[model samples]
Target: MKTRVRSADFLGVVVKYMVLFIAVFVVLFPLYISAINSLKSNSAINNLSPLQAPSHLDWHNYVTAWVGGDLGSAFFNTFFIIILAVLGNVILGTMVAFALTRFDFALKKYIMGAYLLVIFIPTMTVQVAIFGVIKDLGLFDTRFAMILLYLGTNVVQIYIYMQFIRRIPMSLDESAMLDGASYFRIYRSIIFPLLAPATATVAILQTIAIYNDLYSPYLYMPSSNLGVASTALLRFQGPYSDQWNLIMAASLIIAIPVVVIYLILQRYIFAGIVAGSVRE
Candidate 1:
């Protein structure tokens, strides 16, 4: 009976590993194909199956994609937009969250309710109205418009920060107050430092969202000179759609920064999420 039980447990472990192996393959197979094909020439890609490795490494695909796609300007524009938008979201979200969680004011409940309501309402439902407002304000083709939009649309970040802030003991704030520290001083010295994990989580999320956002930048900043990586990738299509190798290479280039960032801050992301969720 003990032998049979041990056999059953061993079978379960084997089955679990098999399932994980299959899942990993399913997720990674496409990326492997892309990476391999990105090093091949157009002719090689046409003749060979993507599942097969390239005959020889052709580094020219990256060069052609970079030069033809004008990726330098695209990357610059995208990075500029991402930095501004993330900064705005982090700062504004932290302030609003701090105010909501730590202070008492008139209509505070109503204000929190409004933010909750905004989250439920899909942004697509009000996109046309937002577009009209941007047009009227003459911000339709500017980077500032994107920054402002990101700042105002950070409800999730604010909510995350507020949850994390609530988990912090209010006694710290009381002690700081007793020491004659101003509100800003307490925030700068105590609250902000403690909220580092949450801030890292917010920055990672906002960075990915803003970086991958194709529609907003395409719609608002349609000028070729102001094109972002997503929109510039479109240039690799149309007329050159057959250049799959170049397209794949460009995609890999664009993805590098996001991958690096996630690797750096991934530890904080899980901790921040768990802390925020387990608290009030």
Candidate 2:
């Protein structure tokens, strides 16, 4: 019986590993194809199977992508927008979450419910209204407009912060209050520091969101000079639509920053997610 049980356990382990191997291959296969094809010429990519290795590396694709796509300007614009938007979202979202989670104000429940409703409502439904407001405010074709939109759309960030904040004991706030500390002081000194993990989580998530966002930038900031990385990639598409290799190279270049940022902060992201989810 012990022998049979041992064999069964070994079979289960083998099956688990096989499943994981298949899953990893499924996820990584497309990335592998893209990387290899990006290093090939357009002719080579068209003639060869996507799974085939390149005969010789062609670095010109990246050069053309960088110059023709105006990636330097795109990166600068995207970085500026991301930094400001993330900062604004983190600050405003944290403060609002603190209020909703800690304070007892009239209409608090309704306000929370409204936020929940907003999360469910698709942004496309309100795009026309938002575009009209931006035009009226003279923010069309500007980075500041994108920043404002990012901040306003951060309902999920606020909710995440609130979840983590709820896990923190209210005794800290009470003790700080007893020492004559004001609400702002308590938040600044005690609560905000405790929210570091959640803050990192929000920053990383928002960075990826803003970086990969194509439609928003395309719609609001359509000026050729003001294009973000995603929109700038469109430059490779039109006349040279057949240049799949160049397109792939440009996409890889655009993705590098996001990949690096995620790798650097993945630990913090996982920690924050776990910390927010599990209650003591």
Candidate 3:
């Protein structure tokens, strides 16, 4: 009976390892292929196996793609927009979540329900209305249009913040109030500082979202100068479609920033998520 139990435990370990390896491969295989293909010439990519590395590295592909795609400007635009959007999202999201959780107000249930309802609404259904509003506000064909659209607090941010904030003891607020601190002062000094974990999680998520969003930039900001990292690839759509090496090089360049960011903050992400999930 003991031998059988040990065998079962060993089998479970082996199965877990196998699943982990498969998941890693599934995530990394495309990145590996892209890195290799980006170094090869267009003709070489056609002749060589997709898995094969380049015999002679050609650095020119990156240069051409960078300059031709106007990726420098695109990256700058993307970075600027992400900074503003994420900052706005974190501030507004935290404040709303704090208000909803810490204070008792009328229609609170209905407000929370409305936020839940927003998560179910398909973005495509109301895009025409959004477009009209953008044009009427004279924000069309501008980077600010993207920023304005992205600045709104979403339910995910609110939920994450609420989960983290709920765990914070109300005694802190009472203590501050007893010291003659105002509600806003307690929120600013006490609540906001303690929400660092949730804030980090929300910032990372919002940053990736705004970075990868091709549709908003493409639709609202049509001007070449205002192009973002995702839309930078669209320049190769018509005539340069056959240039896979340059395309891959461009893709690799665009992918670097977010990858580095995730690597640095990945610990925070996992911790924040776990912290939010289970009651501690």
C-alpha lDDT values of all predictions: 0.84, 0.87, 0.85
* TM-score of model 2 vs. true structure: 0.90
Candidate 2 C-alpha lDDT tens digits along 1-280: 9999999999999999999999999988988888898999878998998889899999999998899888999999999999999998888988998999998999998998898788879776788889999899999999999999988875678878888899999998999889999999998999889999888888888788889888888889999889898999876587558787888888899988888987878887676566444523
Can you write out model 3's per-residue Cα lDDT over 1-280, one digit (the tens) per residue? 9999999999999999999999999999999888898899877888998888989887888998889889999999999999988888888888999999998889999998898777678555677788998899999998889988887534578888888789999999998899999999988999999998778888887788788888878889999999898988776555468778888888899889899999999987777567544532
Best by lDDT: 2
- For candidate 1, write residues 1-280 as lDDT tens digits: 9999999999999999999999999988988888999999778999998888987999998998888888899989888988988888888888898999999999999999898888878766777788988899899999887888877765688878988889899999999999999999988899999998788888877788788887778888888778788888875676468678888898888877888988888887676567544534
lDDT of 1 at 265: 81
The lDDT-based order of candidates, best leading, equals: 2, 3, 1
Give TM per candidate: 0.93, 0.90, 0.89
- Superposed by TM-score, candidate 3 places the C-alpha of residue 74 at a distance from the truth, in angstroms, of 0.8
Q: Which clashing pairs does model 3 show?
A: none
Q: After superposition, which runs of candidate 1 have C-alpha atoms over 4 Å from their true positions? A: 272-280
Count of backbone clashes, every candidate in sequence: 0, 0, 0
Off by over 4 Å in 2: 46-48, 271-280
